[model samples]
Target: MVRIVFVALANLLILVRYLLGLPFRLLASRHRPTHVRFRLAGDPPYRERRRAPLRLRLGGSSLEPATVSSLESFQEALGLLAKDPRVKGILLELEGLEIGSAKKDALVKLLTDFRAAGKRVVAWAVSTDSVGYQVMCAADEVLLAPAGRLELVGYAAEATALGEGLARVGIQAHFVRRGAYKTAPELFTHSHVSDIQRQTLEAFLDERYAELVEAISRGRKRSPEEVRALIDAGPYSAQRAVSAGLVDAMCSEADLPARLEPPRPEEKAKAPAESEAEAEAEESLEPMDTWLAALPWAPVKWRPVRRKPRLGLVVLSGMIVPGKGSGGPVGPTTAGADALVKAVRAAGRDKRAKALVLYINSPGGSALASELILEAVQRVARKKPVIAYVDQVCASGGYMAALGAKEIWTAPHAIIGSIGVFAGKFEASGLLERLGVRRTIIARGENAGIFSVSRGFTPHERESLEAEVEETYQAFLGHVAKARGRTKEEIHERAEGRVYSGTRAMTAGLVDRLGGFEDACRHALNLAKVPTEKFELMTYGGGARRRSLLQLLLSMSSTHLYALCPTCWGLAGFKAGEHFDG
Candidate 1:
């Protein structure tokens, strides 16, 4: 009882601290209306505060999370740039960093947009490596310290195979997937990339890399071939880089900022303490509003302020499972049929919700679960527009769920399709024999031991399971054909368990359009007949923490959700000590 009391008190204190600290933290973290920073070497004069541009420093390793904060900061800085006419230029310093290529792509786009609008983007690097130089290449003024070096290296990808490694330990992996390109489990099944997968991956990398080269060449005013050659022969000194069109000039490290914008004594003024404190407080406020909230100070709100039609976004991420489940970071497995059915029914009953958008980011799993979700989608589509948006890889069961949508929007790079099904069984009779283990079962049916891994299935059992798999495959094809407005023969050619990227999928008639979430939302509003100018996006859940935590708790305790995927892969690296022969 004492221990329990102590624990409760500690929890209470933590809760209080978090509650109180959040507000202040938010305020402190809020973007200042006017950003002020001192140069590395000197202080600014009082009057210069009015002329100073918002000062920001960028850092990160991949756009994932650690870098997401930096991106948010960049957005805030951009907002300041837009509002404050006094804001002159942005100094984008690229230093030693490990940000992901995806994040780099987004940042490049954002910076490009800013530069296009006549904002100065000056990038400086102390010692430029390949990763750092990639970002520098996007800057209007790529500056290198006279003595600094720039290294450009080619791209490479590495994979660790778990198949043979686990085999020696007596563990057996049974994989059941439909698409030839569903390579998620290849980590466990194959030691190296198959020829087909290799070709696809290479093609994708080539396209992205080429885009990078072109963007850099345009930004630096260099020929694409010349820029490519410079990157190819890298590890060049600052002077050499400037001569090769890789940089605008090589200047002393201390003199670059002064050249960008000479520090004026009048630009260094600070705001009053009281006003600064109040501004900070306002910045710390929570982001609680909806669409208008996202754009708080707009001259005119996109939709009406008082009333707007709400859009229901139903996200189905990860592997599909049965029963009920939430989606996202360590959430429930694929939403069970029942959960999807219930959600769709709720959406239909809610008159305020104008339309529904199904956001999917799954590799597909559990055919039965997919069927349940499909049923819900079908029911929802009959009443209102149900649009499907694919992010990342949505294959096999993922495609199954999308079949009921009136239309589908896939990201340009999104991986979609994989209308195939395979049922797998492990035969461990050899391992059992080696261990001197014998099994005897007495049952009325010859296929009674169908689930036993120690023995191969009887012909009757094999035929039954194969028939079921084929039936499921046919159902998948039929649904896709109807949804896509394609005939059976046309879909059959593309639906034989083959995966296609968003671009390829569009050509194959597997997807209606190539777009992102924003496009899907607009399409949904248009289809639902909600005046495009007056609809609201209504997210179903709370903040990510509450939503994700609740989902994890629910998934672990829910007996109905039994997905073989995420479950098997997560445990693959661990020693289950289960011996088998495949």
Candidate 2:
């Protein structure tokens, strides 16, 4: 009896702890604490009542695909700084961050905006890679770490060639893409860079890198010639950096606080709260950032700041899938085909929507789902001016969905078009056979083999699949031709299972214009003749709630119910940032 009581007590305690910790865990998740710290080491309190300086510290690891979450954190920090009245300026430390030139440009752009808001930005670096220095160049004052090394090597890129790797694994890759520029499969087929892939990738990087250099030079008050000379000079010491005017001063991290100025006398020597309730109140009194709060669903905070007329921008991101869910097998959360259709219909039904902009950023999935989304877009287009914006990448079924719009807009670097269909089964029969795992039969017909894992496809099965691909491809071409008012032949010529950049798409009549999401919205507004001051901009993803608690709990209860699609699987990991990492 005593043993049973002890066991019951242990179970009860476990349950209580779990229940009590739930809310705190959620709160902690909502409050993403930055691991990057700033030390106010040895600064003297200000004597002045006003114009007292504040010491800010910036520290973070290299932001990249691996640590991509930091980008969201940085964005939140920017928003906080934008509205913080107490902040006098930003202290940027660029040494620790390992980012590419392109990413640096984006970070620099944010810093420039901060500076433009009447706040000074002082950056210090112990060592600066050629690309990393681009960010430091944007600061009001760039400082050097006394003992830091600065490597000024120019731009270059490296890729992991997979042909040999795959060969060792006994996998033969066949490349069937049409465009020479469509080099996606080359990774598995070629041991070295093809002249085409090398030239294209290099040319593309050169253009973007040059643009960044020019932008940085102007921001740093240096001529392009000076910047170019520095890049060509290569590795330099901190002293050399100071002499070259690349940095304002050389100092150690310990001396940073002494150089900073706080805001006012009251801001310094602030009293600590004595009571826990007071501490709690101080924390709760902090202004919550709506953007940060809405990051889970890619939230947008658009105010009528200037009463700009807003076109209906319906973003159909992610793979096209059936039902009333979001996300599919791969990529970001997407509206279900049915839900998207409803949204499109509602926008058309509302006179206030004025015009519609269908923004697509998907890798394409599910033939039936794509067709349904296409139908929805077509339904909307019939009533009002509809435009399609392809950002980052839109291919295969993505291109199929874009056919619903009257005009298509894409970025110069955007990957658009892949008018094709592909459906293949992964055959594991040979491996299973080698492993002596023979299968016992229990199928109704030969067609059952269509989804079997036991064997490779027969020649007849290949023909049937090819026929299906061809049928889907032709249907895709028909939609493009009809929407763009082009001849069937014209679309057929461009729609041979190929991908093209937005600019090339425009030249080949695949896309009507070369522009970004904003451009697409502007076009829709113009075509609809809706003044920019009329409508309030609204978005879908962030506000749409996930499944109810009961459903989630029930889902957790069933371990065998694995997600068959990637879209549904990635929804739980949905982040609030633009999906444009090339």
Candidate 3:
């Protein structure tokens, strides 16, 4: 009887405790704590036992793909923290972060922003890879699990070749290229890396290695030589990384909360007669980022800066194809000539858009389409600095479009240049003949049957076609020479259809700067005489919506025969930033 009565009293006490905590939840949600906890980690949604419904996402997860709305929501949350004054410091928790270079840049920018707001940033990770360490470098302090792995090993690239296998299977790729080093067609033309491709790859690897060393050095405040030595002996354990000065300390996750800043004194005294429970609830409320969101005003003093309208950011991603529709699944997401031209001209005419940035990620397509867009870009450059940012795959016709920009800035691994031309059609004469099928051609002109797949090119016809392609090649060279401030002869030396990595390309005089989109923006703003604070980035090429699959397929009917690099067309199988590591 005594035990039962005691249990009843305990249940009543539990109910009273829960009821008393109800008001503290609101205080926790609305008030900004002195030390903000930056939950910078995200788990794959699939890992959860009872999967969360889509609506359960407060805004969206960074683990998901970067859609427009998700990106905006992330920026909004970040802005709230940047503008919050009660946030004196931050404790970053990085469980796992998978991101590409562009996203990494954005995260680094966020860290910089929070720091600029006078918040001290600290980070803790269970494990670290090259990417993690890169981001952690932005933090004022970095702590890692004692047993965690620190993967600081350098970069590597590998290429695949399938030419000889195709030939043995009775398929032949009879193609012509203007550049001797254009590696796009090499996979199907040669079983191994050709001498020129090897040369290109070696130079590229050197560039990437150097970039990694420099980045690590800058982050750790170590000399370049020291960083190189450390990276050469990398993939360190957390303890070793700490001993090597790569990390601040080896710490367990539980210790993170204890190390945060002590509460700062309030500017104003609280009202008299406050209950002890209320005071305890307020003090124990912990958050890494400011909870300034949804509040009418900040908890501390802050100024609201209006969004600037200055720089025009025009994205010209995907393949360079003709017509107004995007490409199909079997094809590529095309940058339509009509759409690109419109975007460029619009940026040029917009009075507020003082500078322009052409962010290109394309494996070149239609030569004619590239030329059309190039003309529009050149006009934009005439009015303002058109900084072309080569994201990854910028080759052949893509290079042509980049030439129009006042200066070209390539990402560390950007593939640029292919100042060459290639165009041909496949013939199935042998297969048809072996099957005892014959094709009869009804033609009037001398070149009427030139495009017929039933037969291969005749001797005279082949010679004539070669001459035509040669003329196109010369035209390409002339345009490049004029745009790059080089003579035709000088351009020819580097013209033999060789694609260059950004670092190697700079040495080859193909790109002006080896940096990313941020660098491009800064250069554009500088050239246009615009201050960074006064100007804002306004997107230009987002005027059109993505077309349906049916629309893309139907639009192909409007395309006509034109000069384009077939090697580049096949490279659609290769992702952006993939290079022949040869």
TM-score of each: 0.65, 0.57, 0.69
Model 2, 469-538: lDDT tens digits are: 5566567667878877887788877765555666677888888887544456667888888775334454
Q: After TM-score superposition, what is the CA distance of residue 28 in candidate 3 from its true location, in Å?
A: 6.8
Clashing pairs in 3: 36-288, 37-287, 37-288, 179-496, 179-497, 180-496
Question: Rank order by lDDT, top first?
Answer: 3, 1, 2
lDDT of each: 0.58, 0.57, 0.65
TM-score attained by model 3: 0.69
Task: Tell me the spans in candidate 3 whose CA falls farther than 4 Å from its real position.
Answer: 1-31, 37-88, 92-119, 124-129, 143-153, 217-289, 293-308, 325-332, 349-352, 382-385, 391-393, 411-413, 429-444, 501-509, 512-532, 543-582
Q: Please, what are the lDDT tens digits per residue for candidate 3 over residues 50-146? A: 1111124377434422222233344455566666665566666666665445445566777778787777788778886666677788888989988
Error of 1 at 345 (Å): 3.7
Q: Candidate 1: global Cα-lDDT?
A: 0.58
* Superior by lDDT: candidate 1 or candidate 3: 3
State the lDDT of candidate 1 residue by residue for 217-278, as single tens digits: 66677788877787677668888888777788887645653566553554435456854564
